[model samples]
Target: MDILKSLGHPEELINLFKFKIGGCRTIMPKLDYESMSESLRTCYQYLNQTSRSFAAVIQALDGELRHAVCIFYLVLRALDTVEDDMSIPLDRKVPMLNDFHTYLYQDEWCFTESQEKDRKVLEDFPTISLEFRNLAREYRDVISDICHRMGVGMAEFLEKKVGSMKEWDQYCHYVAGLVGIGLSQLFSASQLEDPEVGQDTALANSMGLFLQKTNIIRDYLEDTQQGRAFWPKEAWSQFAGRLEDLAHPDKLELALSCLNLLVTDALRHVPDVIAYLSRLQNQSVFNFCAIPQVMAIATLSSCYNNPMVFQGVVKIRKGQAVTLMMEATNMRAVHTIISQYSQEILQKVSVSDPSREKTLHTLALIREKSTLSQSSLQSRTHHLSPMYLSAAMLLAALSWQYLNTTAVQTQGTGDMQG
Candidate 1:
């Protein structure tokens, strides 16, 4: 009831209604998750404090779907942390992860040793306290598979063995593309939509690519400091002249010019998110889709003016995040709002520079792609290459909003100067 009140009285402009757009149907066939030995109340408590939306979602879901999703998120978060930890030695860590995957599928293996073996940071996991250890264990296999694919890709990249930009895109697909697949499986299994859900897995993959690419771009400083470069050497050299010299103040202008194009490229997927949201036929799915898209928009807004986003943590204010959530309560408003904000961002860097005409030209292509994408939401031919996917998606999403809003002119608009 508290969640219902929060849902009904959401603080934003858009979240006023809830409905199923597609003809989705429920598919939860299992419910033995009730027998889990873990202190679920404690898990629920931790989740509420950390993620109110997730908590709301858990409360809203049926018993079977709730437990499965909770476990899935928990497992994925653990794997993601492992991937992000620069302090961990790859020699010992990668193998352990490989073994963790095997352990998940092989029930005879013990996870009790896992607690002792993992770094102190992961020692507090509730893996040992669950009856559905088997499920977590299976998901461990999922993590392992993802890692294996990413490991091979990263290895080739670092070794300079990747032959082309095509390969680079494939690498992003291995690590982040699979998240889309995993999410789609979860959506289908939850049966929270019309039986004939029109969800497009390709768009979901693009959405994930947009998120991951954003991280790579924003972490330019951090990744470089750690001796890990996710940006393709081909792009850095071809566009900006040198891969390692991106830190030089002289290159900043050209780099940022090139970077803006990448951001634009990433934005191309905004329509994909919109399309996906429009396809969802249930409340839980709608919330899941809406929250991430809102967060993505907010992240873009926070990163817009802050060049230091490359150097360190960049985040939206909690108050602003809550505002986005409140607004997201209305589906129509969410689309309109994101479109507007995204447009404002594109307008910031739309001007052409003579010195970096080549860079600007690249962005021009991105702008064109965005325009074309806006013209047809169903076309895959407009997809940007992988390394630039985040930048492209960001710019595209923003540009789409900008272009869409530009179609109408306000007559006799009186300006109120504050």
Candidate 2:
């Protein structure tokens, strides 16, 4: 693959981290795709754009781990896109989801005469749909094998009948929890990480839940508007008479209370993330862990105590994102980071209960896993090369400038290339 040179492997495991925070574009240069499967390339391009951080982590990996993980994300995202688009009706969408599942896990994924007849309808298409279809067809077995091993319990949960927050948590495991498991598998298989130091897959599930819960909570209004209801009936019953009624402004007070409970429960996992980050033996994994933790803290800070946080969608500003990243990078004490976020989330809690505060304590205990010795910390800092740091910062400034110029150029051409 011609791209292999650009996709050059990092000389040191720690350097792989540069990709984790910047997104996949950072490592696109290193991935040689000339000889790789077209379906894989199509997925890589999309995954790189959709999840820069995720892409970097993949870029840092080699061979089987990289291909398997990248394809998994590619297939999952394609299915997710099909599942989410409002344009497609459920009859078509459900089948597509089923097709995607079949393609992911089953060997009987070859397009039969029936499917070929269906394919003729898109004979004139010039896009990547065929590759997507092939991915759907050829990769299902591998996807199933991986997911089955990674998410057996979670799959059972997904199949279970839904009713409450308890159910929602179970659902999160099926959909998002397995992601943690799959990622851990890749990390473990690569042998680039310290299995002893990093947060195990089970603990990582809590971090995944925290993220997915935040997503569900933030998108409540938008998802409802789209005729989707991810929040379980059990949780909704605690507030409005019906799921649709939960959206009514008049019922917002009760809805907010329910949401607060969700967010509070979600925050309970931030410490686990801190613990996870601290245990990671690799800098790239650290970046992956840090960025999300920092983002979560910022999200909590922005939404806490503001009824408007749930009124619509909320996000952190670019400036705020930079600040959080810098803070996360500079702070050596994991507890300090968790403590700061704990205070932010605590301010948002509507009730003063010990159980809520106790969660923070649990997280605090997790943070202790990363504590560095005074001499070690001082020695590490003293070894830093100022010249290298300056060079890196200068490159970052130049990259931002180039991106702005390219954006302007692309906009003028009506051929936007990101």
Worst 10 residues of 2 by lDDT: 1-10
| TM-scores of all candidate predictions against the true structure | 0.64, 0.65
**Candidate 1 Cα misplacement greater than 4 A, ranges:** 1-62, 85-94, 97-99, 106-168, 194-199, 239-244, 302-306, 353-418
Q: What Cα-based lDDT does every candidate model obtain?
A: 0.51, 0.54
Per-model clash counts, in order, read 36, 15
- The sequence of per-residue lDDT tens digits that candidate 2 reaches over residues 1-418 is 1112222221111222232334434323367889877656766666666566556556655555566566676555544454445565555545555445445434334322222222321222222334434543324344554444433443343334457768778777767766765566555555666655323766767777877777777777787777777777776677778776866778767766666656666776765676666566755555545665667656765665556644777765543443344345433744455555555665655554324565455445544554655464444332437685556545544554455567687673111111
Model 1 scores a TM of: 0.64
lDDT of 1 by residue, 1-418 (tens): 1122232222211111111111111211222436654556445444444445455544545535566666555444444445555565667556555444444344344322233223222343444225235444434444455545555554344335333545545666756766665565556655666533324558767767767766666777776776776776655665565555666666766666556655555565666666666677766667655765777765765565355555567665443454455455446656655654565565565356332343345335434433333433333123446555545444434543443345335342111110
| Top-TM-score structure, candidate number | 2
